[model samples]
Target chain A: MPSIKQIARNEAASSRFVSGHSLCRGCGIPVVVRTVLNSIEAPVVVINATGCLEVATTRYPHTTWQVPWLHIAFENAAAAASGVETAYKALVKRGRLPDEPIVFVVFGGDGGTYDIGLQALSGALERGHRFLYVCYDNEAYMNTGIQRSSATPFAANTTTSPAGKQSFGKLQKRKDLTAIVVAHHIPYAAQASISHWQDLSDKVVAATRLASPSFINVLSTCPLGWGLEPNQTVRFARLATETRYWPLYEVIEGHYRITEQPLDPSLPIRAWLEDQVRFKHLFQHEDAEVLARIQREVDRDWNNLKRRSEADAQWFARHSERLAKEWTGSAARPAPAMTSRTNTNP
Target chain B: MPLKAPKIAPSARMRLLTGAEAAAHAMRQINPDVVSVYPITPQTPIIQTFAKFVADGETDTEIINVESEHSAMSAAVGAAQAGARTMTATASQGLALMIEIVYIAASMRLPIVMAVGNRALSGPINIHCDHADSMLARDSGMVQILTENAQEAYDLMVMAPRLAEHPEVMLPVLVSQDGFTITHSAEPVSLLPDEEVRRFVGDYRIPYPLLAGEVVTQGPFAMPDYYFEIKAQQVRAMRAAAQVFDELSEAYQACSGRRYQAVEGYRLDDADRALILMGSSAGTAKEVVDELRAKGEKVGLAQVRLFRPFPAAALREMLTGVGAVAVLDRALSFGGTAPLFAEVAAGLFGQTVSLSSQVYGLGGRELFPEQIAAVFHDLESTEGLEQPRFIGLRG
Candidate 1:
């Protein structure tokens, strides 16, 4: 894992993402974008879906990007990235271009990733394109004025799903996009948050090292949409993870591995929901059931993730013992190659 | 700008090929770096034949089997911006789905080439021939070309990349063949050599490739102040595409014996009456013109090969000697004037040519030579021809 100082030094040497244009003052997206871009060593090309990060960073006649960046539409970032990757492969294969290594990265907001872009994302992953897709999930359609999206949490007050009479804000739970990506059987997929910069950076490094598709659904807090103070962006982000609303874990070659355990596993989910105005209605007496439902859902999901990760550890242990016996039993054969698809996460 | 002539002219070989196979053969010859396509009715055979070429190691193309037409075009845009010679194919509903990215591909100035099997848009779900698909994308900033037969489809596919990649006209080009009529019809097409096509297309290099080390931003969101100027650039590029198409066709004529023009006129020089149309239906009109000329009737046919950039000057020039003209459209504009009729009317605005609009062949309705003869016969006496006429409709 790269330390904060090392990341800062690498970013200083070559700032792939620079500070300019109109991203909000305490936006968590830039940190996620910068860390992911800086963590990868190869030449990187970014394909961005039309959203807050894309619109804000790349206003015409001025751009904050210091690397090759492309934005096609609201729901086709993965498709666009697949194109660029395929082009690179074709050019290199035909000797039209030199065989240089490039990491193609796609950044889409929650609305673009979990909703409209879901089919495109699934297709790209299934095709096994050597790219990294990062969903900077800020929950709702922040760029489109805080409209309700599939990633919006239950009882969240979005413009489309407001907390009015006969309404307890949003009627459903947030979509588990990271798990959806993992179900594609990609080499690596993770649930990361911008609050843990080192874990996010490490996952990016791991994801880019493999020559197959990988994904990371990063929880990036939106200050404007969340109706929280700009300074509380990272605080809210950390609170969510600590409260188990968003857990830090990864799936490597179908094996679940927890990257960070919450400092207080017994922390109530209300601590994370009470401060953000989107969930303000959940605190009201009339919406008490919605808050209880949210807390129960979070606890159930966290426990399920923990059990899966434990099962993965046990499965690896048994597999390793069997491999050891096979290796000892045969003199002419060596241990099998540790390919991404076959290797167990340590 | 003229391309440098090769040392030896390309020798052509005759092959019995359908319009789709001819297009696939052109793609095989050009050997674009990337091809991303989805399967539609008439367009399927084009991609299917190209897939066979790829499977046989006949062409060096990275063909992406995208999930939808939207992704197919989106991928083409990405591949083109990445400095790869890219191509894709689609039809009616597929074109409709891909139109959004098609506009983006043009606005970004990516020289991507697309082959469209012209099919009618569906409410009742018809899968036959019409110009509704390509005409639907008329104002999308792509330079549109319609082919009259398998030979033209093959030839236009070969010539499209050069026109699209011209520095002054870096826009997407749509080479359309009338679905089923041309796409499913087999005809003898003269093909150029593979090496010659490779030399013709040459190498494609964008100033700022996404994979290149240099960083550049593409497809940026422009505010009101910059949006108009950016759109004006697309308009200028599209206007320049008209001259570039002529130059490319001339260059192509040098390699292959076949010559092409934006407006192809058949026996229109000495005629007092003419029929103006586009796509494979022009073939039927041409046959009718020849039969009429055999009887000393002063009737001619003018085919609009290039539909976009309107080619108003060339079209107006084609009708200079003709006193009356019948504009035949294969697609309707619903509650308004037919698309081709509107273009012809706008193109011949200042001229004194009496004009009549004739709509036919919707939902793959067969357009016979006699119906075309009737249209020419209608032009013989240009009286009370104000309302648009629907031909062959049993009302």
Candidate 2:
């Protein structure tokens, strides 16, 4: 496995996703995109669902992609990727295509993945296609102008669910799509923030190499939508994980592994929310109830994840070899016989 | 490992097969590189039987078991755009769900062939036989063809790839047959030799494939500067298909000894009156025409084999010298005239011949010889046909 720094260096030599697109300067989506794409070593084909990442990257004739890229519709990236992977298998099997181990990756924003694209994502996961589905979760429909998405956190003010006069921001709680994705029982499901480059980079590496389907939800930042200073984006990203609002953990083959357990438990959630104007109303008024509820939801989610992680630790200690075997390589895994054709070149 | 192509039959031989079976057999011979499919009633056999072939090692095609018709076409768009000869099957509600991607497939210029078991769309949800499913797809920019029997279904399936993947005509194609009426009904259909069918279709090649080392973008968002030019490609492709299909049909005729025309004018060459429609119902109309012809009546029948691309030129030429024509449709446009009637009216807008239309066999309503003969009679007795009338409709 290459280090995150090594991945960047190799990409600088020959990058698959070239730089200089139209994503916002402080936006975390491009960071997430570059990191995830840079981690993969082999040739890749990218399928994107419509969002800020997609619309900003390729605005017709001016594409940021150096490899084969496709954007069909807003909600079928995973479904389309399934077709591309299937095409690779068929062509290679028929000896019309050279047998090369190319990887398939899809990038979708929170609106695309957590909302409109959930069905296609679920279907692709259930079918167990060999690909990586990365969701740059910036909490709302940023490309469509900051409308509330299912991934938007509780009490986060959005255009659709505003925080004005009588309303106290969004009334409903955020959906835990990562948990729903883990329910599919795929090989890997992880949650990482853009502030944590190493964790995000490592997850991307593991996801791209896995023989089965893998999903990683990166908590990207949208400065314009979140109403934060461009330079303060990464700072808020780190504060989010520190406050346990965005826990860094991964589930591998049903085992919960907490990758980042903050040593200090006193990082107030306000530190993460105060800088963003989307949450400014919560600070302007003495809304302790809303603040307390946000903290309660964050702590409750973190505790539940911890309970699963602690229990998983003991179980893994007893069966570490079995767990390691599941991850070391796909050799022991029971993969479907995808094709009868073998590499003639090999 | 190179797959040994299936042994050729040398000459066309007749064998009993269902519409679904014939389609699968054609797929087996074509040996497409990829097939993404999901099962729906009336259309399931095409995919399931094809799956059996893949399982039994009769062919090396990769069959993707998708979750829904939408994904099936979505995957097909991906596969075909990536330079694989891809195909799938759907019908009725499945076709409705996939109709969006069907249009996208054509607009993107992905030459995917989809086999549709024509069934009625929802509302009371009865599914037996109708042209409603195929009707919904007529305006989707795909080259649509309907089969009269198992042989036409088999032959069209074999020809779909050739028409769609032609460099001059890169568009998706839909081959349809009525639901249970033709899909489940068995008939003696002749098939060409496997190698011969393969040689006719040739290998699918796209100039700008998503794979093959050359970096290319597909399904790009065209702005005003180039949107019209990009859309004109479909127009150009459709026109090219109108000619390609004709030439391919002639070539197929030489091989099978059965010449097929885009518009099969059965007994209509010198007739004074005609009944025009498509699908298996054409056969029913032909039976009536035969009886009417034996009685010294100057009635004939014209079946639309190539529905999409309309074949207006051939239709105008076929309808020439005829005094009156009655157009029958199995699918109603609702709040308007029946779909086929509208197209036929548009096809012969300025012609002097009197034209009439009637909606028949909706939601799998059967059309008997008497009802069809009534339509021919209505054409003869009536003068200056205006609005469409519903035949055999409940009062």
lDDT by residue (B1-395, candidate 1, tens digit) is: 12221122334487778999999999999999999999999999999999999999998699999999999999999999998999999999999999899889988999999999999899789999888999878999999999988989999999999999989999999999999888998877889889999898888877788877788999899999798888999999988999988888889999886778998888988899998899988877777887889899999988999998778899888789788998889888879999989988998888888999999999899888878888888887878677799988997
Identify the runs in model 1 with alpha carbons over 4 angstroms from their true place.
A316-346, B1-12
> What is the TM-score (0 to 1) of candidate 2?
0.94
| Shift of residue A258 alpha carbon in model 2, Å | 1.7
- Taking the true A–B contacts (Cα pairs closer than 8 Å), what share appears in each candidate? 0.83, 0.59
TM agreement with the true structure for every prediction: 0.94, 0.94
Look at candidate 1 and give me any clashing residue pairs. none
Candidate 1: RMSD to truth: 5.7
Candidate number with greatest lDDT: 1
Which 10-residue window of candidate 1 chain B scores lowest in summed lDDT?
B1-10
Provide the lowest-lDDT 10-residue window in model 2 chain A.
A337-346
Weakest lDDT window of 10 consecutive positions for candidate 1 chain A: A337-346
Q: Could you say which candidate leads in DockQ?
A: 1
Candidate 2 lDDT for residue A283: 88
Counted clashes in each candidate structure: 0, 0
* Cand. 2 Cα-lDDT: 0.84
Q: lDDT score, residue B369, model 2?
A: 88
